[model samples]
Target: MATISEQNASSISPVIRLHRSDDVVIARSQLVGGTVLQEEGVTVSGLVPPGHKIAVRAIGQGQPVRRYGQIIGFASRPIAPGEHVHTHNLAMGEFQRDYAFCADAKPTRVADGNATFDGIVRPDGRVATRNYIGILTSVNCSATVARAIADRFRRDIHPEALGAYPNIDGVVALTHGVGCAVDAEGEALEILQRTLGGYVVHPNFAAVLVIGLGCETNQIARLVEKQHLEALVSTGRLSTYNIQETGGTVKSIERGVELVQGLLAKANDARREPVPASHLVVGLQCGGSDGYSGISANPALGAAVDLLVAHGGTAILSETPEIYGAEHLLTRRALNAQVAEKLVARIRWWEDYCARNHASLDNNPSAGNKAGGLTTILEKSLGAVAKGGTTNLVDVYEYAQPVHAKGFVFMDTPGYDPISATGQVAGGANLICFTTGRGSAYGCAPTPSLKIATNEALWQRQQDDMDLNCGPILAGTKTIEEVGAELFQLMLQVASGQRSRSEIHGYGQNEFVPWQIGAIT
Candidate 1:
């Protein structure tokens, strides 16, 4: 594989060759047919769009196609030099992956000193980047009542509602669609309870209120007990109520509003203090990805992740299905065989899960993703794994499971942005760094989300939603490390109370989607 320095030099050329062994070179910009590539000694056979692939060498039918010096797919038919390589000509094929556990694991080089940020320290010693009173629903039935309770404190609706409590970030209602018609003893219910429990005690929430539909399979009491939240309830930090028990919808809403009002003064008392950067748990996400994602934003974010790990901070790399073909890269970086196997186990589970559902793991690279130039899941996975940086894989966790290990970790999650991010947030992420090439409008409450653009065109077209532009790296004006350092500093500033672009535009409330599994009956 080529080094970052070597890749940087290629970025300045008309096409980017990630590795010398790669069969294709990415078009830096649109190139018309017959354009000569003086370096590769090939002429463009047809038009190639920016961020799309252009074959630099002839590939025989059924032969493996390479990118980043790794197999991305197999050619479906003969492909001549300078031809376009994409879904139409390249297709999925069986391949054996060598999971050489711990083959490339290395000790992390710790930095000299820890970085600091202005954070809110809770009584339990957990640090928070934002302070809010969260309202969670145990069932879809209680979603409305939960929203109504939070609506009372919305500064937008009633400017004077929270006029006296300046320290409290707005009250937010995080509601999900599944809580009933699920077996009480099934994995689905357990996952739901775990997800809600995580939010109830999240550090960012100064206090939390859980609303439920008394008859739902997901009882609030059961969730509290299973998640060991009895202590929080006993201390008044967490509160719960049900519409049926509270005498119906109107009564439930009124009671909820009253409870939140009573908790305001105490919630407002929470203050920000200087805290070490180790308290920052950022969830790394990439959406609307294009070819430039790996070359620019993703690698840049990975560099930032390496810095964060050096400073004792934690960064989570998730979206298991998205990393299907590139799991070996991570397994080799595992801290031990146990950690590596855990990740492999998740991959195996996903394979079985997809098979049972009559779906293929290669079903990713959605329409938007393909439109942005992604070919197969293998190709996408290779780029996706770049966000984890070069750190050792310290741990692996199930969806919505709380992350206890520090440094770099992996969480099993779907490729859907909302559901994936929700799991990360549940596992204690207080911030999110999302990269996009086609522009994804997303955000998470309690945790501020910073959007990074993969190319300058996307940045300039959607500047309002983007917080940083890694496009300079692709433009040959900056290196990955430089953009990474800049992003790291920006992260600290956002953690210190600067609102992200998504936050400023209010793109969070509607994005709280929990992973739903198991039989509906």
Candidate 2:
């Protein structure tokens, strides 16, 4: 617990320090010159932006700058107390991160065994939060037909008509750009096939219609055989058609519509039943991050994740490049040496991948991030990783691979939020929690995403898009645990069919971006 003075400092000070060991304190709001820091016995030297850091004590050149009790960067030159700490004076430098694999894994305090949610239970005994009929395209050549079929249903079906099939969510066309124009075999193709197959088998989609172009490199037959999709074929839950084989665009679209219409009644047959919380797999995402991200919403989300894991649910932590500097934190929490090694392996692969592209992992903390007071990838990553909470890591998965284990897990994905979230959703994450400090109006289809605002100001400004405000944490009105418990309850409500702000605003129609690796040939 903090002393009275410490509490008062947080409640009334112009700046906020995340850790006692931190050399810098984040400005709670804009600080003009002449403002006094009564608690730290310092005065503002210049204008400091909100979310930007200010030196609370004198520091010399070349010394490490600490935030979250970890080194975010080194001082490029001497910094006086009250001076702003940012890109102009701070720089990224090489440092050793102690891997300390599996050193922090411990038995989780399990929650009461009766935690449950109203989930759509499938005949195969799988649980889903949403029930939708889907049209998936195997190649970009068939994307037009897929969308046309989906659009027809969207335009033709009215709410009154859909009321007849109460369990069905909607018809969605899961189309992508690069099912062709790439190599037919190898790592890239394998990943694509895995992603496609994962979506087809996803329980949320009661049935799927797969469309393909017969002449494309990503032939429907090969994808089916390679991904072992024959089971779906046998069950009649999945149907595939080729544009060329179906005699072109019109015929393909007509056939797709017929197939989807046939699945409508079947998809609507599912009804919500009480199921264990273990059936929930939530994807953790953070975008448009600021310094306050880790301090408030991220940690609050992490608390929710911990709560979910305790209830036997799974939470996926992704955005590999964003986690670059913080991988050690997760490695220490791995349930076994094997899981730890798997995470490390993914990091190494990312290093090689970036090098091959003549890029660096430090090529993050985008313009918006900097404007929000993030200086280095190290600083951004430390904040980003907090979204995973403190659960023991049970597994590590390749991009889009089905997540089988419960509890916390890591997925290999690019730092780009859309791509990362896409991989997570395809991997069977039924719900998403996205924390943003700079306000991003993004969402994912076939999955409900709850947007958590890192600050009250942003929440007030984007009330229509923001689902939850974690601003109280920064205001010293709520502890992370209290807010986390609040978020957990909200997650249950959202999972059981409460529409999120994004869903209401129709923000998730065109954000599916699969990672395209390998040469385009």
Candidate 3:
């Protein structure tokens, strides 16, 4: 894909052609009927919304439509040049994907020197971007009690609550709606336990508390045993209590408060020290995306990921469902056949999972995404994969599994934003870099989230929620590399304690959603 500047250099083009062979071009702005696309040598046949597609050439019914030099979908009907092409004319179709493993894998270009950040170093040599006391629940029944305990220490509600513990970020309670109805030996239980375990040992948390209902199937003891959290419990860094065992909700809340208070001093003992950028682990995500997502923010973020990997840091690209048709892109860049096969296996699993549920992978480009000019899953997937950057896929992981490999990697996760990001955080991402063109308001606790706007209009409309703007790339004022370098610096600053817009608004606490699988009964 040509940079926006290069595409618009001669004269400001009203539409953007991602590839010379693309059947459609994205409207740079609203183009009224009869408007002339001088460069494409076509006159607009009808009104086209900003960021929407306009056919660049004639296409026959059942013919594949290309974008980004890849097939996005097939033309459902004959499409005339200059005509608007969207769901009404474009549809999903089956096609063969060439999974030539390691075909494009290349050695990483290491940066000259390591970048540094002011980070909190744990006694065990782990690094943290923020310090907080986390309260986790094993079942829905203990949610209220956990919230009550965290409410008492709300800095916004009571400014003086943490007067003495300046180092502590804040107290947060991460609760879920399911736990009791799940099978004790099922995948759902295992996922929940793994997610909870990740939080207990997350470096951002100085200490953690687990609350549970004594009679629930998701027993606290089993969770501890399964996740191997006994070490944290033994060291007093993790504490667990049951509402039923504690006698009632009131007693549970009181005990929880007391436990948190006792840990404040120890949590406050954490002090910031200089740490290498190699310690940074970022989770890559994009939500409420639009046409400019691939054109601007996604690729720009990918560039930043390349820079991060060059510095020996790690970046995790997840949302397996969102990357449905794009898996082959990552597979070819895999470090070896084993890594490539792992990614392909996940894709196959999703295919069967969707088939069992009577669903299709094409059931994406949600209403919001369609409204933003995305037409099919293939189109969206092509854009989504751009956030991973051009790098060899070092490893692949199941949902919520710990990420031990450094450099760009993939994780199997659903398309839902909250659940997908939840898995990423559980996999040891200390920070999140999220790209959005439709202005999604999201955050992940324990791990700070940085929002990047994909277009100028969104940046202007949602400036308060956005941390950085890649809009300049869309406006032809900046290149992807330029914005990417800027984003990399911002990552270091945020990792060093500079609060993102979402953090300032306290958006993380309510966004904890673990991926739920298996039967409720």
Candidate 4:
């Protein structure tokens, strides 16, 4: 998407033109008929809502509607100057994008940030932002037992029990709707195993208790063997129990509580120490996006990402479907041909997957998205890709795969926000920065999530939910670099034990929705 330049414009301008070649400008605020736009020397013909576009020049029927210096859509009907440009006049159409493999790729000039945060140091020498005791349910059947066990400590049933060790964050049950009613083998099962394995070893959870039913297709023993969790069990960092094997729900919960108590003591012993920025892995996510997403928060997040990369940290950009039309931009930044090809392969798989399901890529931009001024998947994707910043694409991983390489990486995930974020966290993202315009309320446990508002109004309206405001970039109160710096500093503070708004409100426990693939039968 085009980055608007307001350097030369008056602060009171009613509309913002993103590029010199753009045919439309976004209404900075609601405009009534006959209102004058001094920059464009044009009069508003009719009412235009804030964030909606207005034609700066006459557009012929079937012509391209340009925004962010790229085609957002094709005009379905002739558009005159000052007419509002939206779904009523714009239409989705296919246009070829140049892949240009490795064309824009460049060497990373590693920047010395001299930044450090207080993070927990694990026995394996890995760094963590939080120390939690987790109960992982392998199937929906055991979810109740897992939650009941965690609920005991959560409600302070034995408040003095954990008084000796105060560093442990809390006991949390990571329950999902799946783990049963699916095939025993293939992609779906592999995804589940990988996701579970990732969590089992995640540094944030000092120890994990895996709970399962006696007879689900996803056997707990098989998962442990496949994920090679024998060492963890030996080290007392992991404990497993089956409900039926442990004498049903009541006994299982009791046994789980006893097991968790032992782990809590060990978890509480963990302490935060100064760690370099390289230890951080941040997941980039955007939901409930609006026109200002590209203009403000997304780009500001991108700028922060660039800074993170310079400091040798890892940043993950996911939601494959959401990145559909803009994959070309990322491919150009791929570190090598192999990296670019892996990204392309995923794109092809998605296209075929959509076709097999009798759907199209353009079937995105949900009701809220359209209402917020995003017209098509192309336009949405263009804005979404800005969150990655201008960094070399280092590697690509399957959903829930461990991320070993640093810098910018891509994880294959669904566009659904919770599912996408679930995969990122499972992949070892210790932190998340989720941007929104229409206001998406989301959070993830273990890893703290920082919610960024794309506009001033959204930030004010969702004061309790939002963590930072990127709206100043749109309002001319601050530059993108300034906001990016602010965000980067906030990340370090949060990494050092500063609770984010989401963490403060306990918004992450119920948002753990894993992506379910394959057949139910």
Q: Order the candidate numbers by lDDT, best to worst.
A: 1, 3, 4, 2
Give the TM-scores of the predictions, in the order they appear: 0.98, 0.97, 0.98, 0.98
Give the poorly placed runs of model 2, Cα more than 4 Å off: 1-9, 155-163
Q: With candidate 1 superimposed using the best TM-score fit, by how many Å does residue 62's alpha carbon deviate from the native? A: 1.1
What lDDT tens digits, residue by residue, belong to model 4 across residues 115-220? 8899998888889998888899889899999889988887357676667778987888989988877878777888988898998899899999999998998899
User: Candidate 3, overall lDDT?
Assistant: 0.91
Question: For model 4, what is the error of residue 315's alpha carbon versus the real structure, in angstroms, after optimal superposition?
Answer: 0.3
> In candidate 3, what are the lDDT values of residues 313-393, reduced to their tens digit?
999999998998988999899999999999999999999998999988889999989999999999999999999999899
Candidate 2 least-lDDT 10 residues: 1-10
- Please report the TM-score between candidate 4 and the true structure: 0.98
Of 1 and 2, the candidate ahead on lDDT is 1
Off by over 4 Å in 1: 1-4, 10-12
Go through the candidates in order and give each one's C-alpha lDDT: 0.91, 0.87, 0.91, 0.89
As for TM-score, the candidate ahead, 1 or 2, is 1
TM-score of 3: 0.98
lDDT of 2 by residue, 123-150 (tens): 8888888888888888888888988888
